[model samples]
Target: MRASVSTGQDLGMPAIYLHLLAELLNTIGVDEQDLLLRVGLDPARLQSTNLRVSQPQASEFVTRAIIESGEPGLGILLARELKLPLHGALGTAVMSSRTLGDAMELVTRYLTLRVPHLKVSKRENGSLAWYLVSCGIDLGPLQGFIMDAMLFGCVSMGAQLTGSVVDGLRILRRGPEPAYFQRFRARIPVPVEFGATENALVIPLARLSLPVRFTDDQLAASSRAQCEEALQQLTEDAGFACRVRRVIETSYPFPPKLARVAGTLFVSDRTLKRRLHEEDASFQQLVDRVRLERAADLLRNTAMNLSQIADALGYADAANFTRAFKRWTGTSPSQYRNTWKAAGVGKKTAERVPVAG
Candidate 1:
């Protein structure tokens, strides 16, 4: 199936990842379907490998999974189950790659297609090479789970590609070791060191030339071509408006100015405006949309007062926020929050409620 990326409102984590997670939860005795239902995700939608779950819903589901299962080591466990073929084109490219180095390069470049929030970069010293892993956004409590899945998944993938662990490979993590590590340590193929400078997979430079077990030059070339096309399509489909919305969504000092947002996106102010205009979007409109979404979430879930919510959304004051909010929703902030509460909607139930435009 062909995959298409979307704007910030529709960008999501791959549903397959969540599908695998739910399976793992079920194996561990958690009622996976109920959890998915509570998060407003249909269980059957995950069957399609190309489908994606919206970021908010995915986050909520994952958070609840960890809490319900009480398995902080879920990521590590999930890594073991991620066979090469499950990774789609990137996996095919890696499997057909001529050398270990070639496969690593494909992964570093195309990982965002699978895990949008994580980035991988390669660094080489005199004798040792490191694939440094980092996240694009603040994942908060999910940071460890993501890091574990990524770093450990790399270790598992290496063994799968080469049919054995690469010589002198190890894992380096930034924080102190978690208590759950001892249970899974035997399952990991390589030594793992905690309290390191960064999260990375370390390997000897010479091993980079090791041949992949199933290397096929023609297939590798074709698969690499597919990876290139997929990457291009994903970026193009995001569109200029989507790109601008992404910057606005993640911007610090919430509600950044036009020039700042443009600079962050590596475009001049005029170019940014023209491109967004071509996409039929305005900067202030996009900012207001994001603010309104956040405002709704705060109103529905948090006990924060209007002043606090306004300040969090970068409004000048509560009065200004109330005026803009009324313009957007036809009700004052207090009224909105009160009405939401009066409906007896909690976090889990609120996910199923359709938002009125």
Candidate 2:
């Protein structure tokens, strides 16, 4: 977990997801009050429109659900409730977009307002589009399950937006297909590939550009404004650390300087320093955090070398990058890359470690 902050405060993933979990458990005969208590969540705090829970708390909540309900596929099962309408203004913004492409673009832009820990990156090349999904931190036992729900939910929304099964849509998973595939078999229109190099949603570009039947400019604008307002409120609600992270994450040249980051947030350097101090975070800490995330992505996803990565991240040279990488993960860049490269071998061994009794 690179996702877990050094800060002691448990500000982690968004809790809007709890709404769906609560709903799903209620339908399956789980007591809502008991569920809340078991997960160490306060019913009152969960009611806030802008509440966030720690990553450990969320993992425990889902783990408890799976154990109590006897549904290991709980994450995928959550797709039934992930409809756009069930979401708030953010959903409305997506629904009102002019086309599926526009809708996805909005999602990429605004999703952090609801779930800060999930990051969606999108790329387009003529008729092919790649939407890659990743978590800010390792999500523990629920990692695969939660990813399933997210990818499947995206496809489900595509159908709702287009009024038909999306054409030429395939999901790429980083690991083997789970045994519970049949639970949502009919829902996916195209073949899903396991052991994929990347976890992505592949769609024919034309399908995304197709006009949405219910596209309304006025509604789109109004809903988008609400989304903006809500996002601003969320930034305010979450506190200075998140705001600081947002600034660093968006800045180019990888790790931005403290003065530049403070400038973007429209606060004086001293004020920014004071605010972060209040939140128990430092500018240098956030720089390392953002740099670590980018470095990890580059190391895992790109063929960039030490010099290339160092230059891209504004480091002086390969030696500087090596030192930073060591500080971040306790390993040099090449070693970390090798570890990820050989991870698949361990995955297979771990999968078959226990023979069925």
Candidate 3:
């Protein structure tokens, strides 16, 4: 695998790490390839650094391994083999930071540099709560393919930093269906609630002062500096595409102009365009992506008409928006909206139309 320095140590894909360890175990006579096979992962992938194992595949592999090995800590053991503490540099850096607010900011800011399909936000409304908001990077709705562990991991990262239990945790699903809430309670002592408006962790802001064991100023500074370097380094990596996507997504409701994004990144428009091209993208591609995402949101969450959606995306007219939408998704705007509506989404219709042209 062409591992970039900007990968931020986490490897992003834990399943790949476990597969590598399984390969190592095979060398030592542990034939865990069968276990990996049982979980639908290719043992050949273990040798390829370029391929990644899916989360569900990894979870099943470990679960089966634990059953066969009669070892309850198999998951933790594989995690250790992956050097998770070091790979979890963002979490470790937050734990080493001087203050809770700074730590939260670091995690929120550099997460995408490490993880995929995650958007984090911190709000201090009387108390501090971090929202692990998911944008549809997985090409599905937030709840469609979200990993169950992510909810726990989000809270666990914060609780580990503070060395204090979380006050509460929330999940923004419309219905309560999972029967494993008790299992979650065993892993996370905090109260967990589903059917909330959004997935978030409600932690007390004052707990930010709680002492952590690994508060190394040098490590914190080094990690923060490395994170910034990694981001700057991404200007030359595949993740440069993600940065362009991010800029475009944030600039939505109105299509972001090239100069504005260039200014935001402190790079010239020409330089930004050149870099994006090198990363196999262009400003127009990102804009189209932003429009598609917004169009999906409007179709699923609002009652916006096609004309209004087109106008919001900076299209001259509804016909143009429909053409662009068809180009991006191979479906007409009205067809897309009707499909989602038939799926029973957007129970509450928006009074105003979305202009995600």
How well does model 2 score by local distance difference test? 0.73
lDDT score at residue 336, model 3, on the 0-100 scale: 78
Over 1-357, each residue of candidate 1 has an lDDT whose tens digit, in order, gives 222222232345677888899999999999998887666565755755655555555666778998999988998999988888888888899999989999999989999887776789999999999999887666555567778887888888888888888879999999899998999998787999999988898989999999899898998889888889977877675677766765565444577789876764556999988988998889998998878887887889889999999998898899999998888888888888888878777555444323347
Which number leads on lDDT?
1
Ranking by lDDT: 1, 2, 3
Cα-based lDDT at residue 273, candidate 2: 91
Which pairs of residues have clashing backbones in candidate 2? none
Per-residue error (Å), model 1, residue 296: 35
Q: Give the candidate order by descending TM-score.
A: 1, 2, 3
> Against the unseen true structure, what C-alpha lDDT does each candidate score?
0.79, 0.73, 0.57
RMSD of each: 14.1, 21.8, 21.0
Q: 1-357, model 3: which lDDT tens digit per residue?
A: 332222222113423455555755565466786766554454543443323333333334555554566544333233323322533556567767876667668867886554454567877777655555654333222122233434545555556666655445444433564553443345545566777666665666776555665688999888888778765654444355555554454332357678866654446899888989998789988787667776776667667788887777788999998887787777788887787678675575433333344
Range of the 10 consecutive residues with the lowest summed lDDT in candidate 1: 1-10
The residue ranges of model 1 lying beyond 4 angstroms of the native Cα positions read 1-11, 239-357
